[model samples]
Target: MKPGRNMRLAGLMRKEYLQVLRDPSSIAIAFVLPVVLLLIFGYGVSLDATNIRIALVIEQPDNIARNFAGSFDQSPYFAPRSFSSIQEAETALRRAEVDGIVWLRSDFGSGYLQNTSPPIGLIVNGVDANTARLVEGYVQGIWFTWLEQQMELAGKKMTSPVQLEQRIWYNPAVRSTDFLIPGILAVIMTLIGALLTALVIAREWERGTMEALLVTRISAPEILLGKLIPYFFLGMGGLGLSLVMAQFLFHVPMRGSLWLLLASSALFLWVALGMGFFISTVFRSQFVAALVAMVSTFLPAFILSGFIFDIRSMPVIIQGLTYLIAARYYVTILQTLFLVGDVWSVVWPNAATLALMGFFFHGVVYHKTKKNLQ
Candidate 1:
């Protein structure tokens, strides 16, 4: 009896595998989609601010003003276009030709030299608040450095009372690509794992195959296992491909144990797949299942998972809500493993959450399938 049941389960798995291969959409979702998304996230999205265009308006030309303006030209961060008057600079800014404008008034030389805080105007386009903030910070840094140099040239003792030495951990270079790629991996896995299985049971229902399968000798548990096994491998394959792209193409470091990363990824994939299966079981239409899977999985993974935005900076309620997002745990694990190595303090808790979620989602799927079968 046991051998017959095992054989039946194997046959069901084989049937699912064949069905996956025959479906062009499933093949595209399992394989092609990961690469396209990796390329898009790797190349198209960037957090590093560089080559910012700013108009420099000099009301009066002098040695002091020229020296100050020269510093902006030297910095790689800014592309300074000199304007004769504030009006010209304002025109450039209004036309969106520059991100910011630095204006040095006619009294800048005398007032600045006398420590009167010269009327230096920094007008920044605030369309993108984050970019505006970064530009403002960079400009202030340039101004301070120039001030320090001017003081030293005058033979005055220029020193800060307290010096700050900043050291960043995990990602020492502070490259956004290194930070982004790992989160992209989590998002990609979520899309592939959830979206694929989201269509499975729904497709079975649409084709009138669910009733036929129910009347067969195979039990609901065996059928679910059969569906789960094939797609589980498919999800893992997507993960492997995404990891290779992250390491080779994007040059993201993998400081953790490769085996451990794979293990945690497997746990996360289980949760994602189980969530997809639950959606599939609940919604009979393929279109509805796909939409719900995307809305529930992809959006939460991208937004609440701390992929691009810091959950800590969000409102208290939104921060509290992140605890419910499954991708939050997976993103933490991926970032830690890829950037910080296997810090089990971080990895253990997140992995445990993923395990619990997997069990919960799969248990719900099992209960629903049994009910539907009856």
Candidate 2:
């Protein structure tokens, strides 16, 4: 093709753009999906909890109980309710009115003040394991911090018998959005790219227009590339907007290489497109393909990926299962890029993983399309 004919690429691109624009469902995924993902990930997925009500079923109105409850009241996250009897607190717990119930034994006052151990009870709602763990940590940490301060002033240096020193890498402060933003990039792009591709490709097949194009002797790869170029730009635009939102709106810093950030995101988008293409190839209905692609891509990215939650803390089987998620590696890239700049230790490995996943997914798309062609 000559220089003048190369300009035909622009017209081809424009045609592709117009076709996508004409499809209302395709347009919705491009424009509306990002906002939906941001909303869901922003408000829905959270670690910074506040005003978590705890019923203090104080068997004895001892100094320790009062002091603990008072300490809880001071914190932004805790709302303490002092109850005279355990029965009232139990009722509240059963009713889901309180997240946790703290019970003090009769000897709590004397035992806590003295060298003896104070037997305290902590009953938490086990419905949400993550929340339950956080509540438990807060209650325990607060009580111990208080005790340690008291002991220190009285010429006692009491080291915790069972000690745990947790240090979060990359994101030391552990901001929810800091952890979430990168995974959200993968999730949203996957949703938009895959869902949109499935619909657009399926629409062509459904309308019987693809059959006319098939006779041109053009390879499937060429057609796939043509289809992908348009969507890739759209996906990149969405990624850029999301990055801005993460930085300015959420206050998450971008501490790593901008090149690394772009490369990783680009690879993730490739995988997402492949996922969508695979679905569309197998299933003709845009709605069905979109639903399947979104569910498979989004949930794993959010849940299984080590973005907001730690995979190390989970069971061995669960930890093993995380490898199946491409977002797991992508989340590492995101954190490294945003918080730890030029740390090749983290950057290189994750970059390689993202590339591999992209290749694997694209290969699947290629094989599927080849089979369909035959």
Candidate 3:
């Protein structure tokens, strides 16, 4: 008599577990790869720009000029180097010794004495526009603060039409490491869930083991489940390792519910697994399957998932394309869970989308595999 469906599924899953143990590559991909990636992204990469080098030129070394230059020296954002003349400062800027130049004219003290706005000249290297803007803003902040101090010492209030108070939210310190480490989790899962499974299944096909399994009395759903169950646990193991490193090594805060993070991760992992199954089923060659998986899943997840780049800043066409990338949604969920607390508004929609994509891909793979059996 034919064995029961449950019996067949259990037997197939046991076989897959044995195969996973025998393969070292699978273990490395799931464990070692996350460590390497986390280290590279957490330590090697940074977006917070600090200690900008600036050359300061004072045409007349008066008390006001010296005091104004001292403001820049006190600021942690600037590393101020005094130059005797503008010509020397400009040359230093050209030679890349300094990122910016701050020039105080001879009229600086007189203008402040006459109760007028003293004009200051700022020259910044425009080669890196983002850094240049930051330097300019930091210089302006110093100037305004010095102006207020001068007014207070003179026993007068500085008259301005508007007073602005700024507050930074979410990541108040604005450390890029905090922003990047969470997003890297999405990339890790993509490799573990999509690339690993794709290569393993493709290897099975190349070795003729897949054909041997297909000739058995095992049904299509049973075969697919057998492949998925083992890898799902493997992917979760990788996820657990990544989380431990992210929390202890990198010190990224997890403000959301741990259960919620795990649930979303599971949903996205399901989608990634379905994607791998689809790719391997289409291309039985391991090389072709790996290449396709990297191109189709890894590259898109890295570039279009709003990990390093802002999605709103992309071209509208590209932004719309991001909606199709499962990593995009997963990255959003991760960032929210890590940086912000349990914000259901952000989490629910993204998780639901992942669920839909998972169902769609798994359903397609099921149909395709059933057709192969026929």
By TM-score, the best candidate is 1
Candidate 2, pairs of clashing residues: 255-338
Displacement of residue 263 (Cα, Å) in model 2 is 1.7
Against the correct fold, how does model 3 do in TM-score? 0.92
lDDT of 2: 0.78
Instruction: Show the lowest summed lDDT stretch of 10 residues, model 3.
Output: 365-374
- Indicate the residue-level lDDT of 106 in model 2: 82
TM-score of each: 0.94, 0.84, 0.92
TM-score of 2: 0.84
Best by lDDT: 3
Q: State the RMSD for candidate 1.
A: 2.0
- Per-residue lDDT for 331-367 in model 3, tens only? 9999999999899999999999999999999999988
- Global lDDT scores for all candidate models: 0.91, 0.78, 0.92
Estimate the overall C-alpha local distance difference test score of candidate 3. Answer: 0.92
Off by over 4 Å in 3: 1-3, 152-156, 371-374
